[model samples]
Target: MQRSTPRLTRILACAAVPVMLVLAGCSSDSGSDAGKGSGSSSSASQDQQGGQKPATVAPAKYTKLPNPCKSVSTKTIEKLVPATKSKAGTSGKSSDITSRGSCSWNGLDDNGVKGSQYRWFDVSFLRYDSETSLGVSGQKRAENNYAKEISKAQATDGAKNVKTSPAKGVGEAGTAIRYELKKTGEDFSYATIVTRTDNVVITLTYNGTGYAGAKSPDSADLMESAVAAAKEAVASVGVANS
Candidate 1:
């Protein structure tokens, strides 16, 4: 009976060894899976911290601007402003011609005793760049400025009978403002066109006043000329960018 009891204990101990080994194996596998999951999480966190995502912004359409002085053709200038002092157009002072530029033409056409006709024409251009921090696209910035230009022209102090209308087919969008102002003892008819093409804005102003006995210029005619010149100016932007 003592020998039989010893044999039973040995068998029981042998059975416990396999059960303990199975439990240990399961624990090891569970620990390995946990370690793998932690490593994957750490790798994902590192990727996020290392600039894995980048900010995006809309690209600018027009990177450059055309020369303001030569934007309008000679024939157009000659027809608009007779006997222009500077046939090449007088360029305005601009620290950076690439981003902003302006040109002006003014002259008086004398007709002896019939008095003289005075004419003035000017155009300006502004270009914008895309800014990510501002979260504004180049085209959007130009659109805002285009409205501001129209407002500026309409808000001219001492201007009388100011009228604003949309100018179609000139560019992506445009506005024309016509007003009459008495300056230098003469009534001047003014026409201003503000337009935007992609990332650039163009403002063209045409104003004239009859001197002495000459008749004042017609607003419709002045606006027509201004629109034509504005179309030319807007087209120049495409050419410059191309």
Candidate 2:
């Protein structure tokens, strides 16, 4: 009888195993339902947040820049630098001309009867492309760089009495940075104009000095020339792209 009683208890325990397993399954099902509800809410929240991403960016105004050497006109070149070594101007070395380009003209106008005048002009253009991933427009990029260029000119090495002012009618946005720099025992009047027209940023630097007792170039004259050249350079970008 004792042995039979022990076997009965063992049988009963085996029979209860299935009931315990059934109860566990039911608990799991309840948890799964709750999890599904929470997961759906989370997915909905994610979808709502995702709606704000992937901002639209406008197309760049100018995809390509003008020929650096040809950006300045022949007449302007003649007036700016009287005896330039190259009438076409010297093209600065640039690996990628599509986005950036520069040209420089240097000359020493030797007038034996009236001393000599040295003139230099450097002009550069930088084109910015809209970054869709970064959610930045090309115009905004150019605007940021325009400010940077002005700040950079104001911090030029050896510059003295640096002045900054608006360059009216030069471009959509423009700034003139003028300073005097002494080099090689000569005082050079420097005028730099930083301007932005849409996605393009134009920087024009014009400087001059006199030799053999001639008067140094006037700052006003240099600034005026810089503005004119900058306006032309800014226009060249549109013409090239158009």
TM-score of each candidate?
Answer: 0.80, 0.83
Clashing pairs in 1: none
In model 1, the runs with Cα more than 4 Å from the true position are 1-55
Residue 181 Cα positional deviation in candidate 2, in Å, after optimal superposition: 0.4
lDDT of 2 by residue, 1-242 (tens): 98799767766665667777645543443797868888999999999988566888999978999998898898999999999988888898888999899999999999887889999998999999999989999999999999998999999999999999999998899999999999989999999999999999999999999999899999998888888888889888888988
lDDT against the true structure, each candidate? 0.91, 0.90
Clashing residue pairs in candidate 2 (N, C-alpha, C atoms within 3 angstroms): none
